[model samples]
Target chain A: MGSATPVDDEAALIAQLRAGDESAYEQVVRTYGGRLLAVTRRIVGSEEDARDIVQDAFLNAFKSVGRFEGNSKLSTWLHRIAVNAALMKLRTRKRKPEQSIETMLPSFLEDGHHEERFKSWDEPVDKALERAETRQLVRAKIDELPDGYRTVLVLRDIEGLDTEETAKMLGLSVNATKIRLHRARQALRTMLAPHFAASGGGKATP
Target chain B: MKCRELADFLMDYVSGELPEEHRAHFELHLSRCRNCHEYLAQYESTVKAGRIACGEMSDELPGDVPEDLVKAVLAARKLDPAK
Candidate 1:
């Protein structure tokens, strides 16, 4: 596979892909396959299906390479294609069982006050997040979120998609997408609370 | 603004999407409430942690393509070269 060149010089790569250059396709695959796999796997929650989705994305990109404009960075374009492929795969399948995030969300009192006090972490937030265990816990909590909320969070947060684009991908209203993203973050925070308790010294109660 | 109101608006406020009309009230409440302060900090941290976790930190790939996947795609392309 050819090494990936800088995006500013990607016109040559684009030209090669447009001409159905085998090496260009190989370079694209080698460069983007793993990132696409991670995204697809997060969305579909299955390694086998995610692999197939990645393949479909590559094939589709190859077929449409002739039409790709240089307006966006090549990586962004490929990421969108991979996300669309994952969303399509999700649409075709029977819905998998998804856990509810309600219990993980915060509770409120009758007077509109919070039912619980959120303690400041004993350690600096950045320092705490740098630990491998903390990162693993975060990923696990994200996986536990219900499908709707998880998809919104993944697309809007991790994938850095705009709200409108996320809604379009998931067939959701913009309002619904925003709400889900908020609740998903809130639920994740609730899940990490004990791990960062002021008294616990950044222990893992999870 | 009440705590529940701030809770609902935290995401928008943090993203700077909250309307200027509501920003003052939101900030005013956030300043006075210890619980909301902690909640907001925790919420922001969770967002950052998840991004780092799912992004480059945890989703790293081997530099070379997987042989099986690359071979399968190459074979498929050869069989249907016209497209």
Candidate 2:
């Protein structure tokens, strides 16, 4: 099929698979396996674990493919399975001890001064890229944030999902997602402020 | 709405989820408030930086994935009846 086809071929492919067409199942796996592996690696943070998770996800998808009602995109359905698998794996691992929410709030409150630190986009992209090392620094800092804030930022900002989509994926209210994203941004700004100041970035434009 | 109130609503505003009337209220307040305006600009920039960082790291994932794993996945799929 050409790239411009109108109807979603995923449903048709699934139908073919159910009808015992082997090529359709292979086509689905070939198309989505890499992407699913990448997402799993990001969530699980290990190549070995990601491989296992992707395999399990594929097995689960194979079993449930018949039950898929064509309501959601196939990619999204596969994504949900991968995410669920990774989260289950995470639960079984030894997690870092939980930090108190009270302690988390004070650090976020102290980040109120974060507005003073960005250079506007008029700067050259090369220069911006050089200065943008703060992104790496900020990601490391994101890892330090409370689990609640970190997960929302990863799902929303990093994964490029919209707030409603993220809320649905994470089982949160829309307002709750907004608040978490806000706090996550504030915390990141606080984390990056020092690097921004060190690089002598221009004051944020009003 | 005051700056604090606007700050409370800014995420919803940027996300474009606020009701039209509330959004209008936010813009009216933003028109008069320099600090909130700067705050919004900075917040947007931070989001932009986060996106760039995520894109860069995500791009790295493909290179890091073992080629053999991809081949194995392809081989496994070839045995499926639907594929």
Question: After superposing candidate 1, which stretches have Cα over 4 Å from the reference?
Answer: A1-8, A96-98, A198-206, B59-64
Per-residue lDDT of A1-206 in model 1, one digit per residue for the tens? 33323345588888988888898777777777777778888888888998888887788778887778879888888889988888877777888676777887777787888877666877766787778787778778887787778889999999899999999989999999898999899888877777888553122122
Question: Candidate 2 residues B1-83, lDDT tens each?
Answer: 65656777777798787889899889997887665676677677667766666553443333333556645655665575233
User: Model 2 over residues A1-206: C-alpha lDDT tens digits?
Assistant: 22112235766887886775656655666566666776676666777998888876776787678888779888778878987787668667887885644422212123343334344335422244354454456556666666667678877887677788888877789889878888888776655554554564444333
Instruction: Report how far residue B4 has shifted in candidate 1, in Å.
Output: 0.7
TM-score top scorer: 1
lDDT of all predictions, in order shown?
A: 0.80, 0.65
Q: Second chain only: TM-score per model?
A: 0.85, 0.69
